[model samples]
Target chain A: MNSTDSLIDQLAQDGAAPRPASLPRFVAPLALAMAICAIGIALVLEAPFIGMAINGPGPMLVKWGFSIALLLLSGFALWFIGRPGKATGATMATLAVPFILLAALLGADLAIGQRAFPGETWQRCLAAMAVMSPIAFGGAILAARWLAPTNLHRAGLVAGMFGGAAAMTAYSPHCPEHGMAYVAVFYCLPILTMAALGWLLGPRLLRW
Target chain B: MGKQTDFSGDTLDQLMASARAGDSAAYRRFLSEAAQRIRAMLARKIGADSELEDVVQECLIAIHAKRHTLDPGRPVAPWMYAIANYKLIDHWRRRGRSPIEFDDAADMAVAADTLASTDIETLLEKLPRAQADAIRMTHIEGLSNREAGERIGVGVSAMKLRVHRGMAQLKKIAEKDRI
Candidate 1:
């Protein structure tokens, strides 16, 4: 008998069974890690603006809404891309939606009278981005457990976006600033950091 | 359809289901029939007899391992198609052969046994049996993953994974094996 036959015989001999195809089971942990680090770090730092996000005028809701949406969308995209296959164009498009939505909000901000670059807190943006690096690292490591994605670079890019969103959510509680322009420009800093990390390091870490 | 072993359409699925239920005879018959289909698929994709030889074994091994994982009530074709596609992509990637970036000699087959060997060959020997065998057939013998798997009697997808891993390991080894 051929090797194939032997394998089948072996299965019959051993009673090997099958299981259902899996979804990315790591999403919860990654989101929680981002929240813990963001909130935990914020608590330690005693940033004055910590609980102000829940109270909202319409503008505040819009601002906070975008980051939260990004958090969910990017997180799911990262999970989907974590598997072995081409990152569907639909996934790419979905990931880009928050940016487009936020950018449009920024345009409206400028039309009304907001400064285009009210991001005097550029240093904070850099810090916030740095803070999420660990969260991203955690997500990448967690996702790699059995993911074995075929396109590591693309997966990494989405992974960064996902983790970065989670980090940005964590950091959001602290920042005194509130507006779409601030979020569109500043919140994305970490997302960019994540993309770079994913691009450079993902192929090595995520290989199956 | 006349013989219990003659697989086509629903007959193949029924045989596989029976095999999943632990009928060794049905399992054997199912395997032989499936191997033929897998062989045809590999031959169609790879078009080379030597390379195709090894992967068939891996494909069979994979299918056997994964048999219990399938929902017996469901149609098997979709699952097999997914496995076949995965195996084919994997086979093509190994066929790409990493192009020997650093070596001056750049020869994939090095040392003794042009009859069949390489620095690639040496590394392949150290791999797990299924993976090593898959690579030995696909890379050295130039078989597709399906072809290699059928030869060894494993699932195509499992063989593909073996080939992929085997090739990846070979790349690392090749870095050291560079002459």
Candidate 2:
């Protein structure tokens, strides 16, 4: 037997039993990380505690729907890009849904010509995202480090987007801003920035 | 890792599923079968290139490292080939040529006046006769620079210079053709 044959023998001897790298493996950790961030923000930041009860379910549901959709879609995209031979184009295109929904919401708001602007707690919203995005992103990176992602930049972008979405979801309860325009700009800005950060970091962190 | 264990009845999917479940004997059999399939596939694509074995090893390693990604319910052939194809692409990229096209180019060069392209003949004609003769004798005729120089009654360094100039001129001509 040649070196390759022996190498195969060694691999079998080592018994690389499968602990499957499924999407759920990363999701649980990411969800936990976001939950921790949300609680921390609530205790320290001292923002408005209004949830579906105070704001009514309509706006709160919309906010939760957008962020949660993004969270799940981006999580799926992240998992897709990390695997070799998986086509990420479809998953990536699917990510645009939430963004388009947000845009449509903002457009409708504008057509009605309400005097909507950033709410009093806009700083708190940005602050909450600024804190949460990186923590969520870090959790994702740790989980993805072992998956052997072939395309580092796309993986990173999805990871960052996943972080941004999680942060958005966690912060939604405390945020008083209901303007679609405000949510679109401030919420998306940190997510995009996190994506850029991930893009830059992916090559370095995800290199296997 | 047992001696001569029989696995002829099991399909690759069955073997892989067994491997995933911590059956080392099944894993060994699966890898050996995978190695043969990948070797045959690569031979068809790249012919008898030196990197063939290396690429097979790479595919095997990738399969081992990413075994968890495979769904046990699915057929194993597509997943195996996908990894094999990626390794082949990586091998070709590392070598800086599509091996099939490169092999064809080698064959055409060896064919010389009888089978050479008119485009190549025309390109060679554009060079000075001495430089063109040096390039053809060394490159196409499979002669060393010294042997080619001896045939043309020139020194080895002089022959080398002629071949170098001829190649540079050919590259310039080819680039111009693109424009």
Candidate 3:
């Protein structure tokens, strides 16, 4: 056997650690982040969960639908880019869907002559999201780091998006606003901010 | 894929599946094949096999460390190639910013391995005056921190800190220049 053969033999003795696809791994961390955000909303922000039920869950469900969809899609993209060769154009395109749909809805709202107003509590929404982002970001970064992501920047961006989406989902009940414009500005801004932060920090933090 | 192993019967996917299940023989075969393929791939990109072994070793180690990240449902080749490609980039980045060159001439390798003074001089020139003097005395001149500190009229720990910071700054400069 050559030196390479001997090296292989030695490495083989260590055995391969086979795992299920990474998609399922994202669920636990995301769930924990959402739980933390929910608790924070209840205790710190003092937003009443019962109040949402009183308001009829329609608006809350719509927000959940938007945030959760982005969460899953970005999570999917994260899984793809977390691995070395798995990043493809398709994974990126998939991530854009939620944003595209949200934009379309926002456009339709505007086209129908609905007045767009930055809700009075919009800044509060942003502040709450900002606080929750690090929690979700920490969880996603841990997973991404453990998975040994190659494209550190993209992985970080997706992780940030994932965090933002998780924050939005958990904060939905606290937010009583139904305007698509609010969702567009309040929701997309945090996700993008988190993504930009992730991009900036990826090179430094994600370097294995 | 070359003459490393006869993978005619079982494909890489099957081999990887078996490897993930702790089949030692299959794992060995897979790595052997992987090494050959990675070598060929690197050779194509780098146009030389001078540093091939180091890079291949890094790839294999990475693959082993990150084995759990791979999905058994996916084709193993893509995952393996992705890892190999990443290692390749790492190889390039490292080669670009290699800190010190060691010429292996039997006479020269031993004489001044640490005290490569001219190189240290040029490298230290980039640092601040205090840091550069601290590093020059302690490293190039082979003085202890205490001795160097006294000569430079600083405390021992302060001297050590300067040397440490100077070396770090030098590394940053080297990396920046390489890029």
Candidate 4:
């Protein structure tokens, strides 16, 4: 046999299995969960004062619960996408639906309450969104590279991160009650942290 | 003998698995076996005018660096070809050629035209090691004079002179051969 054929034979015998099928089922859920939790964590950290106003026992608890759920979802999705076969488009769309719904709900609420959103509040939200945008996209792309067999997953992650982050910011300027602190705490930190975590864990978790 | 042939396939598979696990010896063996094919491909693509050995080595290093991206279950031929193609394109770009339009056939023809006859190879063998390397890198490897100089730890002007002198000597030998 030719040397090239021999090299190919060697590659085939090295236990590189075709990517698993359950990838999208895992990835979509994980991405959604991560987004939700990151936003929740930022809200709690920035709005500790809200706890006293509400006469709550602990305001941070709500934020922590959301954050944990987000993280769990992201992790689970990542694990799922790291499996063997190609993930279906329907599976990805299923994951994206909730994000669109949530964005719409929040956007509508903010639009109706625009009178409350001041210039300073809008600025902070815009800044936070800007920072989060690249991080979210970078994280998604890195995750896709790590987990999915095809480069398409990486592209999706990058697109989703930027798209979702941009959408959140675009809607944020309309909400008067949603201060700059809220945007900084909710949107920015989560994406940055997720990006960092994804970078650290990618090689280990997403190995073929 | 039939059993032995089946065992050879199993042995190859085991070697690949071991290489994936970072076994250096398996990787070396794989390279040794693949070198001829790589050389053949390079020779066909760039022709005997250039230093086929340098291209072969560069291709090996690239395959090593990008090996992680290769799907172990898939055929390695395409991946190898892709890397080799990329390296050749890079070679062209470094030499200020617009690599986009340059095809394998054109590259081979250019390489063939630039190569000295076999007699020159004998004369090259007689030069100082560094001088010979500079000549080969500039003429045979198709590296720019600056690149050849950098590679041989000499200045560009010095490298140019070396190549000039080498070519002159080669011409003298060719004349002697004619006589």
Candidate 5:
């Protein structure tokens, strides 16, 4: 046998061992902690979807959906944490999906409401965008850290695109009456800008 | 109990069991015993890089934090080696560089032998058989936690935890020796 093997044999004969616990125990607690924190943040921010409900869907359905989504997101986060190197990119991509949808939906709602641009509604839209921008960036950072993708730039780009798409959906309803032109200028531009920012910042912040 | 032919064996297994049960003292002893071997293995793999000790320490902490996955009946060397190897890979990947492959088995053999003498074996003499065996299979043999678990008939998570705690104890011992 080689020296390493011989040494192993020697150590085997000497015998100083240890016993440690598994990953699930730690992961479960961590998942719980993250869920609690996320819920607390939602409460603090008074996130509209958390407590309020759309009339047709009923409050129960809305609450259940929200709870389910939170649970799923928490589970995803735990998975990402456990395998930081491989899950970061996937988590970022997954997170951007909801954001893009929300943004578009919000925009569409504004459009239907005939909320005037460069007015109170526009101000709210801008404020919402500003708030969301940091959130998207922060989420991307977290995803990159967890996934540990080889090409972070590409991961960021994907995250950005997903974010833009989700945001467009949320903002679609609120689009101004100027038709497609308004949608193109208002919705498309901001989404693109956010996407670009995600792509740019993700790599620098997510490096191992 | 009966003239105790396997004194080290029984003691090591007990310590491992205690660590799994969350005994901090056993955990420390486990780390103390494994540190030198880890250092030696790392030295062979990466030469005398300035970050060797840090890498070893990080690997040990990871092992400690993940030890409940180990099996009581198996060896520990392969698991430790795998962790060290992965850490080195992470270091290179973070630097945007691919791992440098060893050119030949002879070179690897030489390095492995050199690594075996990094003062770990001497420390192992203070340990028990089961602990030593677990350490050897996981750290020295480079087996996966799952594979090691299978050999010892324990769950993968248990094997991982055992490896983790064992490495932590070894590290503590090495630090004490250095001091």
Candidate 6:
């Protein structure tokens, strides 16, 4: 049989066998990596008020909420797109709404207050992107073994974007800054940076 | 994917939706119809070139690989038109009007316009090492998926998956080069 027939037969027999890649087969490993990364961040950073921020209705809640949404959507994009889907642009567009809102919030925050250009915030966020991308990309590359993506680099880019967002989700709890702009600048840039990194590394890491 | 009006998009879209849900019969039916539709579309786009059939097969394989991406809510023609467009551009480029060349590993699927070994090597360079190795052993050297998996220290299905994805990537690379 040609590949499509083989693939369809694969779906039927998949219940009884390990089979090739499927949604959960791919998701389990990436989730495990994110969990591990979350634990590592909590232990290593030892942020003072993580528990309060997580529990309290502060900006941390918003940051975490937005980051979690990004994580889920990016995760879905990564897994759903694994087999046959061209909805990445739409999905990525949905993914961008929060960032846009945050950008607007950042602009409004600057307009309302004489905020000094958060000098170290830029560096911190850039560093976060640099650090988190490889972790997420590494996680993604590991999962890439089973998840077959047709648009390889785009898969890698989304995977990296997922990674960056996961890192942000984990990192958001630690920071004292609460503005959406702060979250967007410090957090989102890293996600995109890693996504860009994924774009470049996609041609290499996600080749097959 | 551009526009093609030869077939009813709704019928093909439903067939694809059923196929994605694991209906083999639906998928087979879809392919039969899609093949005729794609062949006609390519003939119109690229003219009566000798590589028409080869490009047709390539487009079919691409459609199968990307079948999951087809939105049942949308028209299949545009989805199909996109795949055909990429495959045709790669085909014409492989017909040697472009400077860059890909390995043409899908050649075994079609006997038209067979490529040389050196072309494959240069082409494989663009891929990651493991994927390059997997495609080389399986497609170029004709190793069975299971045998290639054993050689590469991966499972047979993964070997199949890699080779499948590798060729798709090669097509993407070739398309990008045309721009």
* Model 4 Cα lDDT, one tens digit per residue, B47-131: 4423456667666665654454455544456556666665655554454443323232433343245433455467678765555
Cα lDDT of model 3 by residue, A100-155, tens digit? 88788888878888653885678878988999987988778876776778888888
1 or 4, greater by TM-score = 1
Highest-DockQ candidate: 3
Q: Write the per-residue lDDT of candidate 6 for residues A68-166, one digit (tens) a residue.
A: 887888777776555443555776677677677677777887778754345444665566556665776677766764554556677778888888887
lDDT of 5 by residue, B1-179 (tens): 34322234544445555554556566556565566777777666554444566776666655554443343443455445555565666665554443433222332243254435456667655554445555677667977767877786655544544455455556556566667
- Measured on C-alpha atoms, candidate 6 has an lDDT of 0.65
lDDT of 1 by residue, A103-150 (tens): 887788778885536655667765866776667556655754444445
lDDT of 2 at A71: 88
Q: Interface RMSDs of all predictions?
A: 4.8, 2.2, 2.0, 9.6, 9.2, 6.7
Which pairs clash in model 3?
Answer: none
Q: What is the DockQ of candidate 2?
A: 0.31
> What's the lDDT of the predicted structure labeled candidate 4?
0.48
Q: List ranges where model 1 is wrong by over 4 Å.
A: A8-24, A28-32, A48-60, A78-87, A116-120, A196-201, B1-38, B53-179
Off by over 4 Å in 4: A1-45, A48-122, A132-208, B1-15, B21-25, B49-51, B97-179
Model 4 Cα interface RMS deviation (Å): 9.6
**Candidate 3: segments with Cα more than 4 A from true spot:** A1-6, A17-26, A49-56, A114-116, B1-11, B100-179
Cα distance off (Å), candidate 1, residue B42: 3.1
Candidate 2 lDDT, A1-208, residue by residue in tens: 8977997897778564767546567566777777787787778755444655656777778888999999889877876666666677898899899989988988998888875587687887888889989999987886676565767788888888988988988888777667677888789888889988998898778655
Worst 10 residues of 4 chain A by lDDT: A58-67
Predicted candidate 3 versus true structure: per-residue lDDT over B76-141, tens digit per residue: 777888898888887767655765432224322322543344355677777778777876676668
TM-score of 5: 0.36
- What's the candidate order when arranged by decreasing DockQ? 3, 2, 1, 6, 5, 4
Best by lDDT: 2
Tens-place lDDT per residue, model 2, B1-179, is 34323334448877876876779899899999999999989766654334568888998898887776665455678667877886776665565543322132433344353334446677789888877787788777879878987775655645665666666667667666766
